[model samples]
Target: RVDGEILKGWPTPTGKLEFWSRTLHDWGWPELAIPKYIKSHIHPENLESDQIPLITTFRVPVQIHTRSANSKWLDEIAHTNPLWIHPIDADRVGISKTGDLVRVETELGYFVLKSWITEGIRPGVAACSHHMGRWKPEGHKGQRLGISTVALNQEGSEWSLTPRKGGEPFASSDPDTMRIWWTDLGVHQNLTHAVHPDPISGQHCWHQAVRICPAKEGDRAGDVSVDTGKSQAAYEKWLAMTRSADRYSPDGTRRPYWMLRPVRPERDAYHLPLKTESAEV
Candidate 1:
């Protein structure tokens, strides 16, 4: 506090909090400068009649990022990530009961997971808890607690993750390794998720609008199918929404002075002209 008074300031272009962002306006985003209801790509009104919003941002209380997936104590409480669908919506998708297999389809491809019918989530929305699916490629160094070793097959723009061996009882130097029993490690849905980046905030849009349907004949648990071609298209679509740095950096600087930098570079290094020339080699 300055002189024991309350001090209030924010990290905006303005010294104080900004009601309208001048930086956004000057970057050719005048429409987004003011705070108002901007419709998301998957907004309810914008969604097609058959589509349901898939909320991918929810996290289980016990886990923190992907690291805690290897924690035996945490995995015991919450291990599997079932697709949470309301009973009404579950019926529409032919999911009769909890634990039934369901395929959630995105623009790129699909992932099969168990169904969880409940009134806990909204009727028209489906949610899969974040950070449950953690896998390691076969022959790669991996943790034993909560990760499964898998074989990754790639053909052109398509990728698939198949389980090689799940966590099982085995003789090891550590006695606790034999005590491990649970094997229902969740599937990695993030692999199939197409990136939808926010133009202004520069954040990947996590919420998706997906088609919920019954699992196909060959679909298995923990299976992820992705066509990288569609993923690349989604990335380019969002990238085009953003103003080009080459065009906007009239002052020769890459970004605004107030923007946070982890390690501040030399002043001359911030100039794009000099930086571009050095990269030519």
Candidate 2:
């Protein structure tokens, strides 16, 4: 029994044993080192007091940082941004299935999204999957126009507008060209998270405070109005700094000489710049 050893208690101060293992370190990895004796234990007391109104958690597999919606395959799986809420809490807020978009507000900012009432989440807590609804680029496979002509069309399924379709030339009538007009494509949940600090750890809790409400008809998905005056001011200040002559290089270059690094040449790579007319002939 290795008693009072610091390595024994990892991530927790008491170093309590967590799981059963034959070796002190499993799989020949130092990070996996654990005491064999510790069995299952509950550490609910280690968490912050339940009375604390604000808490922070994260989304599940359905969402990934602003990119999942770009994939037609992924979007087809999880179509909408559904806020998972406890049935009790859902009732309190008058939210229900088929509910219109709900406003999720945090100290950082607020935005409207659809609600999905489920018993899966704890009653004073709400959850959302991070993986759905991705921002569509000017032209991509899952955008409104991209879906109509390419993805939905049975004839030209081969002409997808994604990285996979990179080398393939687009058909002339491809509706992907209309995607340029599609704006305000999808919701970005990060904007709803505020920058709040955790008192115990002095760490910023980005998801600390959030509230949900049903969105009225005509309300756009990503519309959130929070005061970003400070951010605008900072941008203006940065613009002013960049405009100053002293910030520029002596030779009128934007970047300073020391900051630039020389590019190393690749010795073993093949290089064919272009075919000569004689060679083509």
lDDT per model vs. reference: 0.83, 0.44
**Candidate 1 per-residue lDDT over residues 1-281, each given as its tens digit:** 57998776687756677889888777667888888998998898979888988999887788887878757678778877899999999998799999998999988989988898999998999999877778888888857677888889999999888877766766677776688787878888887788988887688899888999988898877889899999999899889898866787647677777788789887877777654344564
Off by over 4 Å in 1: 1-8, 274-281
Error of 2 at 246 (Å): 30
Query: Could you give candidate 2's per-residue lDDT for residues 203-268 as a string of tens digits?
Result: 544444355667766565545444454334533543442232223223443222222236633433
Single out the weakest 10-residue window by summed lDDT for candidate 2: 158-167
lDDT measured at residue 31 in model 1 versus the true structure, 0 to 100? 86
Query: How high is the lDDT of residue 72 in model 2?
Result: 40
Best by lDDT: 1
Segments of candidate 2 deviating more than 4 angstroms = 1-57, 66-70, 136-186, 197-204, 216-218, 229-281
Model 2, position 91: C-alpha lDDT score: 69
